[model samples]
Target: MNEPIISVSGLRGVVGGSLAPDVAMRYVAAFSAVAPAGAIVVARDSRPSGRMLASAVHATLCALGRPALDAGVAPTPTVGVLVRRLGAAGGIQISASHNPPEYNGLKLFGPQGRLLTAAEGEQVLAQYRHSGPAWVPYDRLGGWQEIEDPLGPHLDAVLSVVDAGLIRSRHFHVVLDANHGAGGALGRRLLEALGCRVTLLGEAADGQFEHPPEPTAENLAGVGAAVASAAADVGFCLDPDADRLAVIDEAGRYVGEEYTLALCVAHVLADRRGPVVTNCSSSRMTADLAQRFGVPLVRSAVGEANVVSAMVQCGAVFGGEGNGGPIDPRVGLVRDSFVGMAHILAAMARRGLPVSRLVEELPRYEIVKTKMTLQRHRVPAALDALEAHFSGARADRLDGLRLDWPDRWLLVRPSNTEPIVRAVAEAKTRHQAQELCDQAAQVIAALG
Candidate 1:
């Protein structure tokens, strides 16, 4: 807790606490050290600390003699798209994603427009802990420039994957809850391009969040009512960095994040039969869809990097985590909220169904998540005990301990960003899911 959570995935910390200008600078320096010989695109979400961190990151890049292509206040996926479109060596997004405002962090992208793989992250971490910044002299210092059109490439890429003409023809009304994160500008543009009559909430690209920024059911409770009040056809709520999405139907129903990927996957696979990938901790809805489509369902460990790695291995056409991030390979290889909104609207326009009706077509399941704080050394034994306690169920140790049954499942994994263990369960009903988590909790508690 005293230090930022640094990993290959990214670095996140409390703005004034574990995260500061120097921390941001050193992390960027490490990235610069390993990045290829080209400019590095830097961006941030609409957090207050983002301005401070962006300054330090640009300074670090310039000091290291790496040109800083600054795209101020863009979505996470937009940063990725800019990196590839601009032909940069890499990209860095200064946002803590769905974390609270007090938290801000960096997410790295490779030249391929994907999050740094675990191996690539290890290389970066080694530089951070072991090497000092390679400061340059005055003559060799790097330069900085601002990008003029950050959202255009990202918007065009997302619009390309969906039927823009058909969606525009529907002229559906939409409610966008950006919650003052970096999603508003690009999200608004994408919706307007699709010809949606927009009721945009928290449209400002400031850190002034009206609600919590995660876009969960609890965080987005008011969005459902807002959607109904606007008489909109659908509501799309985006997380802070705009990589994830959560939906609300016209009936004021929170269709939830898990359904985001499932809905998009089902829609894509209905037309194109290719392998689909999701994380192990995601809902079984994706697995069911892959089965229904007679395609392979590949479950990677829980992380965007892991999912992308699995996707590349399987050549998955459509993939995402359970967290409302659907990845269409046609778009840049990142978890994109724009991709979700466009595809969901296209699904509605093509099928002539409401968001809720489209949701009903998919098989339903309930998911429950709980956590416990245990020392790091005890984790393996704890998982072993849970595995033994649920001997009848199948177990998988891909990222953590996962026990599977026909209709329900439980996953126990250590938090990569927090000092706790997370246990998730899903089943046909909420009670069934809760019971599974409770059983797992008892097993994990008995270990202590």
Candidate 2:
């Protein structure tokens, strides 16, 4: 039997092969057994498989004597909010993130509307292995309910963080590409509320993607051209689940996802100075902003849960990942694309500068990423060889092998699921960044 790839926060796998109804039910039962007895909020993206999985999740929760509160199709972050708002025991989001359509997964949240910590996640895993849910008596089975306006409160909370009035007055022309995901539901409302003359692409919530769903520069070529042709001020593209976001400048240049967090941090820090947190893989521009504002910046491992954990520990006002996941403490702990959009628009409106100019004003850096195949057992030897080759560079094993230079850095780590060593570098120029990755790959290859 195929097994799902379960992690601390949730599980993900290819549909039909590894992610069948039976496997999903078992995990749901495990989660229900461990969670406090209360209504559990459930939401999903616009994936074709989401409806089927949602039904399965509901059945499992009901059978375990836990009421299921369905939020229907919504972003992952929205599910987190509804969980807190309705006082649910926890929440489940059905999304594979930026993975292909063939892949789908479930993300679990705690009662406080946060993803489970490492300790809490271990408890759920143990329950899954043990395989016994404390089912209530036949007369005490949990009930089910549906929520019609899950996005309303989320929209209000996001708008409160930014100057909606100012953004509306600017009358900016905006282009939004939802790619037929759940984002279209709220993305349209947020844009309209901001009073922008909006042109939407792939607005249907049908899970039919016009292009690849990741929102990377290469995949956003059509969005770039649409921005230029529409003569809009900027373009926004969201992944299949809407948890991640990428931007295109007014000039039709893909500014990339790395700037999503940096741009929002710059805006927030300009008004209020406070601590910021991000994963180790985030760009150095975020660090530069913290330095300019004299605010502390903390780094965590490369994951939303890690970043959120550090943010709470450090009392950070803002935190996110370089992959377009911006987490605003005011909104929720999860990375929210809607918050990023609202903040960027508010910043542009206040400064009265074009999106292109605003991007140019910030510190710039280039990042190059590459991966190499290696057996899992050989990772230790590869790390030793890499450290020896780059003897002059400062070495740190916070998450993996990280070599730091005065103005550049390279991170060599193994993929969580694949048998490949991932290498990432950031430098002052694109060539320099690529060179760093190439040098690391060459050193690792020589060891093999």
Candidate 3:
């Protein structure tokens, strides 16, 4: 059996092979052990293994004398909001996110309804490694309850962030590809609330996807066609867990995930005008939007928790990653597809422009990503060589070695779980970005 990919957020692995009930129980026990004794919200995506893992989490929470509030299958962000809405101590989302169907995992949340930070995750790991969970006595055993209205509060929160009245007046024709994941439940409701004439693909919340689960540009060809053929105002494609959203313009262009954060930031800054936060790997389009608004843009280390921490520190009105995850503090700390959809539409309506035009108004950059197989021990040497090779460019050693030019930048970082080094570059042209990535790859390879 392969080992699960355990990280600060949670653990993911192929079901039965690496992630079985025992492993899930142990991880859940570790989470419950560290969490304060209160109602813990448990939710899952539409994966086939979700029920088994969710049951394991529930039973473990109960056995540990901590109440478990079952939210059934829902998006990852919905679980976070539900945790806060219900005032639970923490939450667990049984989802592998964009991974293949065979993979499943647990996503743990802190009391304030956010993913655990690096320090908190380190504590969880230490507890899991050194000592077993501290179980409760029979007299102090916790209880269990089920909540069916998970989508209602989430929908309300999303609507609050946007002008629902204006959106409903527009009655935008929209198509949503939920990919048969847990997003369908709240997604459909939120669209209807905004008076969107919605054509839902994969409406059922069954784990079976109509295509590859990730909402990448290549995978979203069919969605683009659907939007154009239907003459919908826009199209929204969500990953299996629905936290990440990729947009399709009204003209049938695959705007991709990177633009999701940029467009949302552009809209919010136009009206609210405050500090914006995103991870280091995010596009400069966000920074450009901040500059246009005369606001400060703060960059955090990659990961939702890190971004949220920075947003809190900077009092950012909006924050997210470049991976199509938009975190609206008005809604919740978690990245929300519904928030992305609402804000994009509201931005379009307020601007009196089409999605394509809105995209064109922002800074344009091509992001190219590549990876090379390398041993973990060689990463330091590779970073040193790359730094020397790109000596003229300004370098940042925050999460990795990032070299920045006037309009281009390259990031070289090692994969936390895989034996590979990830390289990402952005420039005005695809060729330029590719060249940057290739150069980094060669430098890393030479380190051997």
Candidate 4:
């Protein structure tokens, strides 16, 4: 079997090839060993392999004499919130996120309802490698129970963060494309709670997606067309786990994920002025918003846990990533598609502007992303060349190498899941963004 891709967040791989039943069992047991002594919340996405993997996790938790609270087929953020609501030791979400259907993985969350910090995750990883599962005797075996209302707390949490009554007054016509992931029900409930007239695409949470589940521009052309045909005020698209979101205008234009954070930051800063945090790989729009609002915008290493740690340390009012993850601390530390939807709709309601107009108000930048297969050993050389080539610009080595200017920026980071270096650039125009990415790719290729 191929070695599974392991990280501080969690592990993922092709089901039968790398992530088999035994592998899942061992990993869950490893997590169980280090987790606090309390019930563990377990949830899965809509993928078929989710059930198989979840069963292993449940059995392992039970065998270790830890009670397992199963939240069946829910979004990843829901599990995060549920962990804190239930006062459990930690939580595990069975999902591969936006990866292809054949892939599935697990994401671990701490008791505070956030992804585990790097230090905590390293302890789990070390325990998994050095120790074995301590299965309990028959008399000490634990039990299992299914959660009756997993979505209720999550919905209430999101509603509390936004003015639901104001959103309801507008009665906005909205389209939601969940792509048959675990978010269908929650997405519908959130819109209905806000009194929006919602039209759902792929309402069934059967893991059978109508299109690719990433919510990218090219992959969601059909959804954009549907939004235009329905004449909806806005469209929201979610990934398989519903942690990421992308926006579509009434005219069927894809607003992409980067704008999701910018719009939410705008709405958040309108009412509260405090620090904001985003990953190093996120777009510069948030930085622009922070400056416009006269607030500090702190950039962290590229991960949800890192962002959450920074937010907690800085007491940030809003934080998220460029990949459509808007993390409102009032809601939960995890990236939440529901939070994104509420904030975007609330922004529209408050401004009385169309989705297109709301997007137009924000600073716009063209972002281009590309990746190249490069061995780990060559990464340092590539970074050296990139730094020397762009010596005129300010450099940031937080996660990888990020070079920045007043109007443009370039990021080169090695993938946590794949053996490739990803290069991303944003500028005033598409041509400039593409040129930056191409130039970085050339430098990496020359290292060969």
The 0-to-1 C-alpha lDDT of every candidate, in the order given, reads: 0.92, 0.91, 0.90, 0.94
Where does candidate 3 have its weakest 10-residue lDDT segment?
126-135
**Deviating ranges (above 4 Å) for candidate 4:** none
lDDT of candidate 2 over 176-285, digit per residue (tens): 99999889879989999999888989999888999989999899998999999999999999998898989999988999899999999999999988899988888999
Candidate 3 vs. true structure, TM-score: 0.98
> Candidate 4 at residue 90, lDDT?
95
Off by over 4 Å in 3: none
> Residues 87-152, candidate 1, lDDT per residue (tens digit)?
999999999998888999999999999999999999999999999898999999999999998899
lDDT of 3 by residue, 1-448 (tens): 6668899779999999899998888898888878886899999999988998888888888788888898898899998889898889999999999998999999999999999988888888887777786678889888988897878888889998888888888889999999899998788899998999999999898899889998888888999999999999999999989999999999888999999999999889878989999998999999888998999999998889999999989999999999999999988999988899999999988888889999999899999999999888888888889999999999998887889999999998888988888898999999999999998887777765
lDDT of 4 by residue, 1-448 (tens): 8878899989899999998989888888889888889999999999999999998899898899999999999999999899989899999999999988999999999899999999989988998889999999999998999999899999999999988999999999999999999999999999999999999999899899999988899999999999999999999999999999999999999999999999999999999999999999899999999999999999999999999999999999999999999999998999999999999999999999998998999998998989989887788888989999999999999988999999999999988777899998999999999999999988777776
TM-score: which is higher, 1 or 2?
Answer: 1
TM-score of each: 0.98, 0.97, 0.98, 0.98
Best by lDDT: 4
Instruction: Give model 1's TM-score versus the native structure.
Output: 0.98
Lowest summed lDDT window (length 10), candidate 1: 1-10
Q: What lDDT does candidate 3 reach at residue 94?
A: 95
Regarding lDDT, does 2 or 4 come out ahead?
4
Residue 163 of model 1 has an lDDT of 85
Off by over 4 Å in 1: 417-419
Model 4 lDDT on a 0 to 1 scale: 0.94
